[model samples]
Target: MTTAVAATATAARQGPRPRGLIWTVLRVHRPALLVWCAYVLLMVGWMLWVQHVSGARIRAELDACRRRPEGACIDVMTFSHSMNEGWIGTFIAYSSYGIAAWAGAALVGRELERGTAQLAWTQSVTPTRWLTVKLAVPAVALTAGTTVLVLVYRWFWSADEVLRGDEWYYTDPFLNRGPAILAYALCALAVGALAGLALRRSLPALAVAFGFVLWFHLYLDDHWSELWPMRTITGTVSGHDLDALPASHFWPLHLMTTGVVLTVAVAATGAAYWLLRRRTR
Candidate 1:
């Protein structure tokens, strides 16, 4: 009876097995996770600073301009240009491309190239679950990071409209202004994963993934204006004029684009899973 009780106690102490697959995935990609977290935090911090400190300063300068009406203030102009055209825009574009490259080279391609993916499958992790984990972990992380940045960016963009910053039609601003950024990030990840699965070579996969993302963005940017129907403004004296859609109309357009991009992401992820299954079989 004593020995049986001791055995039961030991069994209770052992508890349930840990989720080794998720732990392994996270462990293998911890460095990328840390970098992504840092990037999100840095962007949020910058937007906060711009919204509170820099925005206030710009407002004050504009007020002074109204009062004095003398010369253009270099500081205000420089700050406006930087916010509209510099770091914010550049960061948004690069981050999307970076994700594609990382997904292709580090996440999927490298594993397949090095036979680690096959080894994982041999260890009882099925190909489908492995692929699912690969997609799910990054999707969640990318959504979280992009959502935070978009919310902060929207605040900053709207708060200082009088400053005449970048317009909504601009490529970077359009992408960064809403949930579309998250969609794009996910699309990039899916595309990269598919490329990696197809090529089974890290460098070539990286190149293909980055190229696809670039092409996708360029095509979208070129055709974005036509995504939604244009509302013509006609005056009795001025006749019909083709005017840009109001800011209120942007959400629908953004939603449509997001849906399209997400569909592509889903399709690519499915293709990758199918390909993996076939390869394993």
Candidate 2:
């Protein structure tokens, strides 16, 4: 038997087995994982230290505000050294998302552009398996990193109710445990995969992926509930009391955005498959 026939027969005999393509891909790109972890650790430590150093100031301001029942000074939950929710934890979250977006783009975008994808795909691996591994590796890594970020933010801000008032700003529905984060991540991944397959150049793929990510982030930040179907749960502080309310009047938007993300993911993966199959070189 010829080399190709022997390999095909071996593959066939192996049959279908559950595979962790994502892990395999991630192992091949272990440096990305290390960098992701280091970044998360550094951010968490920095935020915590900043918060600790400024804790006295926050308390003093809160005390002063409490003393003056009807004054210009108001009690607010400060994140790190900034009273603005968008400045500290949220900023970190946004940055983390951006990095993840770039990492996703770098996944297959760089490899395919470098012709490494062709080499891997032509192995005993099926196209589906190849793509799955590519997507799975970075997706899992990004998801894990994002999860750490969300947990850190939640833990760090748990003590300060003042920061909670800007529910829309602080919670980052896109980073939360819902369709928003999934949509955002999947959108970035799909764009990267699609761009890599179509453009076949790292720089062009990176440009396209970054452009899409920027547009998506801006759109979601501005019209989250309007375009996402996810409702912002609003909480209120009255006198010395805090009240939590379920103002989740935006479920439809979440569903719509989820559907859009699903469509993009499916289309991008399918297109990549077709493109690779048709390529003669």
Candidate 3:
């Protein structure tokens, strides 16, 4: 009896077991996690390759082409480098779209539609808790991967302005190289979860979530430039580089847009909780 009591005390001292709801969330979403890992690793490797390997030579050739204008400018190397650098931002942005679709289709809606969520509710897990776990697992995973990506992208963006000479004002460049990446991803997650929970059907939720993300991205494209007041320059700035927005304007617009995205994310998450409470009770 003393040994049994001691064992119980030791177990209690250890706190909660490792095999709980969080672990179950990881297990159920293992495939998605694996895919996220693969994508992050691949993107990091590609960025490093472009930065360290192909950057300097491409910059030299492009400069030479601009200076001479008579030599062959449309070389394969230039084309290849431009193509790689140009699409990276779009690819990174599109990952959020995929995440939103997956979150709606497989993460939340499928569970509810197939009765798995209801079954889990019959256990000790409350309905609210179940929904929280679903959102939290993907949110954590996305944050981790996006953190890695944003760090690597910042490094690449800072190091060399060679073949990858996209301006900061560009949408993809703005997103891939800053905190906005994380904001956009979390926003996608929350919106997708809300779609899943509200619809309770897999296919429809998937389409709606994906479309919603795309629409938001388009909205940003339309209005992001106006987030912060533009810096006006005096004098003959026409045709001068000063006619373009300067480096000084980069962070203000970036931060403002990121803040906007994050606000939407919080609102969607709040709506999710409110909806959950109403339904479960």
Worst 10 residues of 2 by lDDT: 238-247
Say which candidate scores most in lDDT: 3
- Candidate 1: deviation at residue 269, Å? 1.0
- For model 1 the local lDDT of residue 91 reads 92
lDDT of 2 at 90: 53
Mind giving the per-residue lDDT tens digits that candidate 2 earns over 1-281? 69999999998999875455554676667877797788778867765765565665777777777778577774344543454434554555455345434543577667766777778676777767787677776677667776776676666655565544345333453344345555566667767777777777777777777777677676655654455333333454443444232435334555665676667667766877787677633
Off by over 4 Å in 2: 1-24, 50-53, 64-80, 89-105, 155-158, 163-165, 169-179, 227-246, 250-263
Q: How close is every model to the real structure, measured as TM-score?
A: 0.87, 0.67, 0.86
Cα lDDT computed for each candidate against the true fold: 0.83, 0.62, 0.85
Model 2 lDDT on a 0 to 1 scale: 0.62
Better of 1 and 3 by lDDT: 3
RMSD of 1: 3.6
**For candidate 3, lDDT tens digit of each residue in 1-281?**
99999999999999986477889988889998999999999998998888767876777777788887476577767668767777776788668899889988998889989999889988999988888888888888888999999888888776765555577777788878788889989998998888999999999999999999999988887888888877665565554433346778888888998999999999999998898889888
Question: What tens-digit string does per-residue lDDT give for candidate 1 at 153-185?
Answer: 777677756664677877777878888888889
